[model samples]
Target chain A: MKSGALRASVQLSRSTFTLDVDIAVAAGETVAVVGPNGAGKSTLLSIVAGLLVPEAGRIEIAGVAVDDVAAGIHVPPERRAVGLVFQDHLLFPHLSALENVAFGLRSRGVPKPEARQRAAVWLERLGVAHRAGARPRSLSGGEAQRVALARSLAIEPDVLLLDEPLSALDVETRDRVRSELRTHLAGFAGPRVVVTHDPVEAMVLADRMVVLEGGRVSHDGTPAELTRHPRTHYVARFVGLNLYCGQASGSTLDVDGGGRIVAAPDEPVEGQAAATVRPQAVSLHLQRPEGTPRNVWPGRVVGVDATGERVRVEVESEPPVIAEITPAALADLRLASGDEVWVSIKATDVHLEPA
Target chain B: MTTPLPVRVLAAVGFAFVLLPFLGLLQRTPWSQLPSLVTRPDVRQALRLSILTSLAAMFLAIVLGVPLAWVLARTHIPGRSVARAIVTLPMVLPPVVGGAALLFALGRNGLVGQYLDDWFDIRLPFTTVAVVLAQTFVSMPFLVVTVEAALRSTDVRYEQAAATLGAGRWTTFRRVTLPSVAPSVLAGAVLCWARALGEFGATISFAGNLEGRTETVPLAIYIELQRDRDAAIAMSLVLVVISLVVLVALRDRWYRVQG
Candidate 1:
């Protein structure tokens, strides 16, 4: 019930899909909702922004009830003090940067002169004052993004929602804009929600990450926590770790599908648990060799994907694992699809968590 | 790609069919007497009345047609397709038929006109106002159809952006939606004005061609052709020039929208 807090429990059903989620963010906290396509990430933001009405739920922003289906108190989007930055920025094509920033203020009954002056201040703060007279179509992508952020922030809303803010930028501009966005987001004194599918962006901008899969929150944790113990296959793939669920007893764990992984003897695991192995820790050899490695499995290479400076080799072993190796190592192994290989993992590298 | 020879030959024929009338008008024009013919009091009166009434009709079309267009393009009202068809009926209906229909509804002894006469003492037929109304009846469809098409194709996301910025529906339409489609609106207005300026059958049937009252340039031309062919030719030339100007000004906009 804090003044700047945002809380929502929404349930909406469409013909094709249903979204039901409950989330709460304290004042001054930034939470990132990361999910794959069609997971209702945008729908969640829309509900909180008052652009969409939930079938049966309540949404409160800054301790004010914006939507309550049972209470029949559904505020329209224009009345809700929520600022939304769409993926493409959606800058008014006909207006100059200064006028675009002043739109919200002018709409709220601010006098033209004062609104323009305040908008000028925001433009200066965002480092786009020089382009204030330029139309949105004339401004560069980075400039437009800064103007969009300024426009949303100029409203001085109780809560801010950004939907895939950096997804529209090219690779080169995304990094620069992302860092600038983080600084701007930190300056806002309200609950902030960012929706994105990129794991790196979620890790960098958000204080906490909420993983949404199939319109449900599959995992919610800090970057490090989620990286260490991913609860679902999507999160496991997101962090590039090989995950397995099994029954763990003492130092050994029996995987559910079909594999046995030995854990470090120091950490005793009991009952049903999950284990994670970093792709970097899995070494592949052409033949089974004698080594200090506690876990070794013979499997056939099912796929090889060369990404950047590393190659990910998918092996159809007992548990089916993905191994990341350098191109030099791949060249030496000459790994390709359908090649036979032996995979080895050190016991210490196998981290286990209770499922 | 080159068009086939038969297609090219047939296209030339069609083009010539359209252009031949303008060439005939130019050939028959009394260039030496044009100055005296166009400056006659009756000719000037008709010209002034035509400009005034057509401008009035164009204004009325914008006021009424924009909202109609918005409803057609944005709303899911019941019988929307039927409503759209009814609104566009004047475009295909003969001008004389449309005028006759208007007479049955708004004439002094007619359905709504009888009530207006009883309660407000207002008569619409045979007045200068009737000319404008008849012209608007025929020309408004052009504006409505053009604007509705533009509205349908416009991006709705900008309006959503406006809402999130604390703009109410009216403000969003005025500031964002209207400006985004301003070009199309201008093109539609010009077309409406041109159509209104050339309206003839509707004005003659519904409003009656009373000189200096409802006798617009087109009606004046028909009346003058019986006695003063040169004056009629001069007035026709004026209308043709005005229409040509409108078409040239709107050419790029029309092509951009269609293409």
Candidate 2:
């Protein structure tokens, strides 16, 4: 089998916003669509799932053309064999967990006993076998979502549509559930699309990540590619890179707001562009250190906080920076909130992107 | 003394309006004449007629009304609003007007009756069948509106989920939809039955209240109030008791309403 493929580009025109995008995911491949609040990520998922027919688009899922308005080839959601797991789980409140999972089988003409048996296997795989007899209201959020996953998988759908699967969980639970979801997803051989605003979920869950900004693809690459060079402020913020727009002619580059800084000549920029550097790339010193570092700025610490095992200092430097230092380094430097610090970073850490 | 003030007031007023009138009927009843009055053939016939006609009317209403309610609640057809309006017209229409309308449409010289008489010399007005029609026409909307509201408020996502699982539309409706809306359907059924049981004006006008053919308990009580007060009072008590018992029993059983 050639598996699943989608060459669909959906465009929806609303008075307030127009959604235009093209996406593809091969069989057994997980594609993570990530963006900011109004990035139309969910709208793209909706069009692929056949929940909303795009105002204009060609949707070919698993080699079947589902939405071809000109050819009158609009297959409804029910017939498309594409499973949609909603943000809220959307488990039928009236049905027991076992029944909820068994429902997909019933719809597919499987015998009742056989359907229940198959659903039991799915529930067991998700480690919710004990909760199969309970109602959705009685189950916890994580358990209900597991049941929803079982319900969707019971029919053996060609494509799985996951919208913010881990977004509803508490932080601790999100990590555990995302790992468990990864295990289950790895076992299933189908094209899957997961939507999320969290970079952690996207990078950890998807095989190939696609970023949508302003209803268009700003970047398409692996999780590493986006973190390496963030063209937009949204991606820069996500990867914890300081982004600045400016003019760069040679070793001495004057950024629009952050004053002048040196960038390599080999940096690619043909027009208006941006430069990004990770806070970790900036080395903090108690005094103005003398060296040939391409970027070095002095600032008084504004705030200090410990996150996880690292102490992060908020500084009031030109084009301000947030530097993350190990607790060992913090203790050695005896860092304080009002301490004056010089931040030095190597030239290679600075990434350039056309605006 | 410490009972909530609202609760105490509610109990006092509710008992006065609901139970005191039946108590007054019981107090004024002529116990010696009760047996003979009820045993009389005319009273027996009217009681039988009332029970048969009201039940038939309620049954007929449910058969047509439930589907209508489902359509109004689910579909967005252009004329659906008008259809719902037309279904409710009879509920608010004056009983005499509805009776007269039925007569014009199905009476001996009326459009439907004219055709019937021309073909088989048959007509609907002034018959037992007419009594059922009159009661049903005046009562069906109560059932339809109640069920429609229930269906409208129900979560439709469950139905969508069922379809995604592989169940067709009809199966989803039969197994899931109907069970989900069962409570409302029962409530509507009870209301329709009560309305049909109490139906009076249309039954008299369209069915022509006669001694055995059309005289239900309401008409019987009316005629006897002028000729025989004791018998009329006795029958009034019977009708009131039956209505109370039916309402209380159904509410408790279906709606889980405490006494």
Candidate 3:
């Protein structure tokens, strides 16, 4: 066990679902746990925070065993030096922002004057010192989020856990608070775990990302790695790439569900491989085009969605493909839903990963 | 939208049914004698005793009922539902029956009372303490029910947040849970106090209505009605005013819960 590290391998079972995961984070590292609802994202945070006990697991924080099921050791939540920032902030409605931040210090036997002094410093660092006297009900969403962050940080715990910290804010406030959170998280020396369903938040806030799907880790990698070679369907969609798995031999690949795509990877392909093509790498044409591209197929356009300056066109073919094109290209092709279109992908643009 | 004519008419009749008794009391009140009647020494003594006993009952209810409310709201003890039913039984039981039950359990020669007398030389029946006990017996359910409902509705995530922030169970209860339901506790105490102020059947049965001891305003009113009707009407007017003040004070909280 490394000093100032968090290591947890936990398994819990319920009537409807089961969660099994192993995660570790070194000091000064932030890991984002991203998953769909009911994927045990919040459950993982709860277990780490000592709010929920795992039936079988060992959790070590800063080289101290907070929970070891086999050893019959389980430290209660109050005894575990863990800071948790909830999705809704959950600030004490009766307390001022300063008192909220001081709560942990006071509970730990810090004198009231010293607690208030330290709390004031944290509130100042979070840029909400002026709002210290205000109750949570009066603060704006972003202000409340900052206070919640400060309250958690004030305790100076061994590990920091944020469960959708910016999810309760409005879209306008969410962007600013997320950036501010990134700065604060970077400043903290402890291991940090942030749980979020938003891929962008995970990518922007965390040094590495863990994809939890159906209560198990499906993929774990850096943002660039995840974007380049997404392992799961959810991740592929999140990265806006069309992915396929199939048998690979030489430069030709036979995709599952009756599709064929030619791929040229940096390494030679073997028996089983996964291929990913960015939406931008795919192209749509009204007629079959003569080009150096190795992969081309005719398919009916199933959906057309306008996103900002570009449009995403989903073509219903064998191993369906999504192609992103500019509005000018869309107009040039005269694309619409249910229209027959030809899809093309260059062999070099199809990235492969070992299955 | 305007209410339907039939509904409005029926509501008016219901409202009148509730208001007619107050109007009758007012009509019988001798305005010239009301001041002197209320200032009489016996009336003053009963009034002061009523205030002291009712306030004591409210305080005792809070000290004991809040913890009971928390247990009912948060715990999963066996037979919790049955325990809750028993705790709230006083709300539905007749005040006379509750008084009799209290007497059987706590009267001088009664079950627990005999033990108290033999071991501690404590006699509870027909005392000022008995008056407070009877009032608490009949009114504490109001407090417990209100606070329990508030605790049930509070977002427990705040308590979880407190625990994660290093607050122990007692600290979480004191700093988070109790303050979150403060308004409900206050409203419950006010309701309990009002109920205790008007207590007659319970005090008469258990405490025996001793002047300056257990003879609260309600008991005094009952006694005055036979000998001095004017004094009874004056005391009834005082109670009516107090009830109105309580209603006004609780209007916002009541509507918030109802709405």
Candidate 4:
């Protein structure tokens, strides 16, 4: 059996929603499960952590059968050798920083002094050695989270699960802690599953990203692939790509909303497909540009909003599209709500995926 | 702003209703003769017995009630609501009735007590242990209710974190759960001990006021009231002073409710 491997097929049903997905992570791979709220990202982690038992599932961690419903083998959370850092960094308030980190060792029957020594080493490794004697209440949010991470890592678990690890921090702290967390996770050599709603966090921390929607794995690929060719509407919106779902014949794709767009030559000839065009690929022109290399369409500017250094111009076309242009371009075009505009895209720039 | 006349009058009356009796008791107390009155051999014996029985009762309450509280708070035990209501029944029941119930269950030749006497020659009634049991019967509900409320309000994610850190359920409870609710446990133990010390109707009905073995301060006060009024007043003064000191010391800790 390989070390730090996890394979699980989780199935759970509630009156309002159902979560059924099969997922796996190899040794030293950090898989980020990205989703909107109530999309079962936390539920998936909880199932793997043995905190919530799925109605049906088989879980194998490091080739060990942690839960096999057919065999009635359900290992309890304490015996699973899986570490989970909760969303809020739920550090035990009563214990000092060192004791909280040492809790795992002491519970597993290490002597007090040895456990304390090991905990101190973990604290030092996480760069929180100076706060070893402070209680959780005295520590700031980042410090408490580091203690929580140390407490989880002290067990030397086969799999590490982080549920929204950086969501509880302020923006500045979140950025710093996220980078620190990524560094620490890289050193653990375990199958780490991080659940987060932030696309940037997913892209920065994970080797692979799994996009979950309505409790299903809607997209599974490398961060580059997801960024270049997102599959779902949520992913497309998240990665800021213009996605269209339609049927394709030869190189031309007919989007569902009666608009036709050309796909890349390498894309499938005839089948249901999705085409993703980056917002940057869609150019705004005052008038139709003369060219055989472009797919031009007339659209009404429904709204214009500034995001970061770019302004996103929402074009109310048959199949709506967002064009990311420089703020200077926005100023030159004078793009505002209810303004008429011409949108153009090159066929070579449109990336297509099988829906 | 001025308070309404009716509200002020009603509030004053409510304060008087609770305070006037204690004032009258203090006024009647033979403070000058208190030392001699309380130094009587029987009074000293009763004081010792009261402390012993109440402390013993408190020990039992903590040992048994904490687990019961956890069971009530954390588990999905069937009929848990019914179980909680039953556990709190003693708090509302008349102490004399609770004593009667205890007698039927533990008295010699009564229900389980008859079997105990027949099989092991154990007679529980009218004994020092019986006094403790009677006090415990009426006091344990306080501990259970307080601790269970604390456990229910506690954030359980810490326990989950402990489990992920390889701590078993028992370890989590001891290391994580117990410490988180320590203040409530201490508060509950104090309330239980106080209730046990004030136990009279149950202790008298069950343990029968034996001077050295089973007679507690409350029981001694009752017995002395019929024979010597000054001694009774002295005993009452001692109980009042001790209770006041305990309540005052712990007021901010347990009595000051949080929003």
Candidate 5:
């Protein structure tokens, strides 16, 4: 991979919201900016792509000062070496798929034939060469998105920004296009940022995850680190983990309300800490039994919700526990609302993050 | 789910109110002598002049009105509503009033026209150019209003996408914005040409009905009405047929409303 970096601090004030964030991406890095709707995810990409002007701060792409408020320098979007694929794949409806991909080249003064040749190459590379002659309105959703991707990538941009590239596709098409996008991003040397509301997509396409909430960066780390120890409830919920914040000593975590959790292999976190345990790690039992598992609590079932093949049993224990059990296991245990049950979790299942 | 009987009767009355005049003109037309009537030297001259002036007026309106529409629709020019009202004033104003206003602006010894006549020796009133100018003055507002509405409704994100793809402002407008609003432009131009072809009051007021120079079909029809009503009816029937054919052909081919 070639060396290219994008570093920027963006600040904007709007009537509905204010966005202030500083982000950096080194060469060959793909960072997923994940957030719910209206969390400033698209705004961040827009600022980096020079589509929106910042109120303050600066942006440098590939060592070029694209925007510097104090220096009073701002490069127009057309001159900036940043490519963005909008959420809706805003391809030129009047142009063919190949022409849409060739637009950037033609605008930059490349010869017509050469630009078309290069656009064809990109279309083939993105697996949409057969549909190159079709206009955007005629192309399928997935095919249009692929053409949009090819169009952006054809510019050989120093920084690439994708705003929810797969959110428009159907479930079946999403998976295939996602993997294809991953392959393309892996080969591109530029610093790439993919903004998506789906944590699953972030995990699949990004090297690092940056979670935004209400226009603020709530968490930034590797996918594993974020999933293992989410700092906020949104992040924890996003990764489907049960998180608790309390005080921790050598091997035990004192639950804020009542019960104590013992850690099998505890790290050196002594004060305020958080522990995340996957719902799959907790098991339900008919009665108080279990010798191997250290943590056990008796609680009544608050709710039983089924998602996909697994049934989630929410137990109102001391700190409240969610246990994922198979439907067969659920039927065997006859777990329903207001049913008494015992939940057991191995201490090793709890991953702690020291605050 | 069905229209009331009274409403249907009112609609038919409205339709007949507009169609009756054309039917009356067709009935009065001298069918056997139509060829001779149209081939009269004065009628032939008026036909050629009317076609020339209307075409010229349509061309001028397109060249000037499209950009004005863009400014009105896309830019944040202060007092935009006031500007739009002024541009569309000719649409509603009496054609003779519009002609008088043009004379005040462009006639010899008039405000700007005095200097034009003194310095450039270009006397505008009662000339062929004045006929084109009068037609353009009355017809341009239609084009501007239609094109402006089209421009306002175009998706601006397409232009943003073009900019991000490295196309500058002018290139984006030429390649993306213009093409997007082309159907409206064509429709506006056709309407403008039709209005210009039928202009009578403004042309007579601003550009007097000269023999072969400034006399258009409408002016010729007005003149022939005083001498021979059959010739006037013949000319009116020709205009009605031409307008119907042009409008139907254009709407069917170019501007068919999408479902």
Candidate 6:
């Protein structure tokens, strides 16, 4: 068994629903399970933590073989040594933050004084030592969430499960708390599974993303891979990628009406493969530039969605594409809704695929 | 319009009718005879016995009923509905019928009682234990129903947090579940004690009315009512005053528990 490795193939069967998934993770790594509602992402985390049992598969945490069908070895949650941080930060209202952390250590035969000392160090590391004596109800949402994370980490479990830890906070507090959570996770030398439906959260907080849909994994890849070429329409829309149904040859590309584009040698195989372009990669021009490039499409801007400081323009070409540009860039290009412009993309940016 | 509506008149009159007896009894209870009537040897013995057996019965009921209520409100076991129905059976049974059931279950001539006596030579019927059993049988459901309702309404997330912190089931129950339902538990125990203290039919029938033994205050009052009406009225007045004083002192706690 390695210090931190988890390999699991979980199968859950109920009267109306079934979930089957195969996943693996390594030490000091974070895998974010992202999906829509009812995707079994939470169920997958629960199975790994031993809170929920999978009927027909095995689970190995740190290669320990916690669940093996032939040996009939299925460990219960109490003995699994996995820490779970619930979405609502389920802190015990009666116990103070310090005592809550010490509870796990005390259960493992550590003396009360020693457990309290270890818990105090953990609280200090998480920068929440001031809240050691406060009960959960008296603490704010952000404060309680930190306590939940500290309590889980204090146990030093082999695996960690975080179920939407930042979703319960206000939008303003989510960013700061997520960064703080990232710091706490960085110091953990164990495998971690974070479940969130937010693409930005999954990207910022996890090394890899697994997209679950209809109780199965639709795609599994790094954040960059998932962002650049989302295999499914769900992931495409989630990552804000502009998808086009197009065809590709040696170095030329053609779509229904998105116009001609260039292709890299390793373009996708023929027949109905998707072409995804990041909105930020599309450059707008007032006229077709006299340059050696693969793609230049004429389109009218149909809609403009101002996201953060960047404006996302939806262009009505043969196959519509959304281009994200900074406010400065939009102003320089003098772009607005109903503006006719030539959009030029380089061969590297004009990604191609089979129609 | 000046006389008020017929329904309002009838409601006010009905309330007055209910209060008139207590008020009249208060005014006519021969204040001069109250002291000697309550201080009499027989009266004192009945009061002491009532308080003793009722307190013991109430303690026993709370000990056995609270965990059962917690299980009913939290677990996912099979036949939970059936288990709940059995728990509430005593609440629906008449006090006399409950006493009869206790007799058939633990009496010398009944099931399991013969062996209990034959093995240990212990007879439960017609003794102090009989009085405790009868009171408990008719009063425990009050505690169970109240605690069960409280447990049902409480948030169970705290328990899950305790488990993640590595507290076992028993530790969680003692430190978390009990305290969470503390006020309700106290309220239910108070109700059980009051019900047991005022019990009459079961104690009189199953344990039999023996002076200084099974003749509780309610049974003594019944016996005295047949002989001397004035003394019984004086005894009833004393009981009312004691009840009012206890209730006034803890009225706020009781209301909070109920809400």
Chain B TM, every candidate: 0.96, 0.89, 0.96, 0.95, 0.96, 0.91
lDDT of 3 by residue, A1-355 (tens): 1239999999988565688999999999999998778899999999999999999989999888999999999999999989999999999988999999999999999999999999999999999999999999899999999999999999998899999988898888888888889999988999999999887788889999999898899989998998888888889887778889899887677898889989888777877888989899998888898969899899999999985689999999987999999999988888889999889999999887678
Q: Give the per-residue Cα lDDT of candidate 1 at B242.
A: 84
| Steric clash pairs (candidate 1) | none
Candidate 5 residues lying further than 4 Å off, grouped into runs, are: A1-3, A246-271, A281-308, A311-353, B1-4, B253-258
Q: What share of the true interface contacts does each candidate keep?
A: 0.84, 0.47, 0.88, 0.90, 0.69, 0.37
Worst 10 residues of 1 chain B by lDDT: B250-259
Off by over 4 Å in 4: A248-254, A257-271, A280-307, A311-318, A322-355, B1-9, B255-259
Which has the greatest lDDT? 1
The Cα error of candidate 3 at residue A289, in Å, is: 6.4
lDDT string, candidate 2, A1-355, tens digits: 2357766777887555688888888888898998887888887877876767888878887778989866777887778787878878878777899998998788777899998999999899889999989999899878988999999888888888899998777788888899989988887788989999988898899998888888888878888988877877788777777777777664455677766665664744555667787878778999877878878889989988886677878788786777888999889888898899998877877766565
Give lDDT per model, in order.
Answer: 0.92, 0.83, 0.91, 0.89, 0.89, 0.82
lDDT of 4 by residue, A50-156 (tens): 98888888999888899988889889899989989988888888889999899999999999999999999999999999999999889988998899899999988
lDDT of 2 by residue, B71-132 (tens): 99999999988888999999888998999999988898887978988899888898999999
Q: Write down the C-alpha DockQ for each prediction.
A: 0.82, 0.38, 0.86, 0.72, 0.66, 0.37
Root-mean-square deviation of Cα positions for candidate 3 versus the true structure, in angstroms: 2.5
Q: Please, what are the lDDT tens digits per residue for candidate 6 over residues A240-303?
A: 9877665655666566555655556474456455566778888888887778656777889988
In DockQ terms, which candidate is top?
A: 3
lDDT of 1 by residue, A1-355 (tens): 1247999999998565688899998878899998778888999998888888999999998778899999999999999989999989999999999999999999999999999999999999999999999999899888988999999999898899999999888889999999999999998889999999988799889999988888888888888889988988789988789999999998888999898999895668899999999999999999996979999999999999995678999999898999999999999999999999999999999887678
Model 6 chain A, poorest ten-residue lDDT window? A265-274
Residue B99 lDDT (model 3): 89
Candidate 6 clashes: the total is: 1
| Model 3 residue A193 CA deviation in Å | 1.1
Model 3 chain B: lowest-lDDT 10 consecutive positions? B250-259
Ten-residue stretch with the least lDDT total in model 5 chain A? A260-269
Q: What are the per-residue Cα lDDT tens digits for candidate 6 across B184-219? A: 888888788888988887777789888888888888
lDDT of 5 by residue, A1-355 (tens): 2357999987888665788888899878999999777889988888887888999999998788999988998898999878899999999988999999999999999999999999999999989999999989899988999899899989888988999999889888998888988998998889999999887799999999999888889898999989777888788878888878789886678877777776765456688877788999999998997598988889999999996689988889888878888999988998889999898889889776676
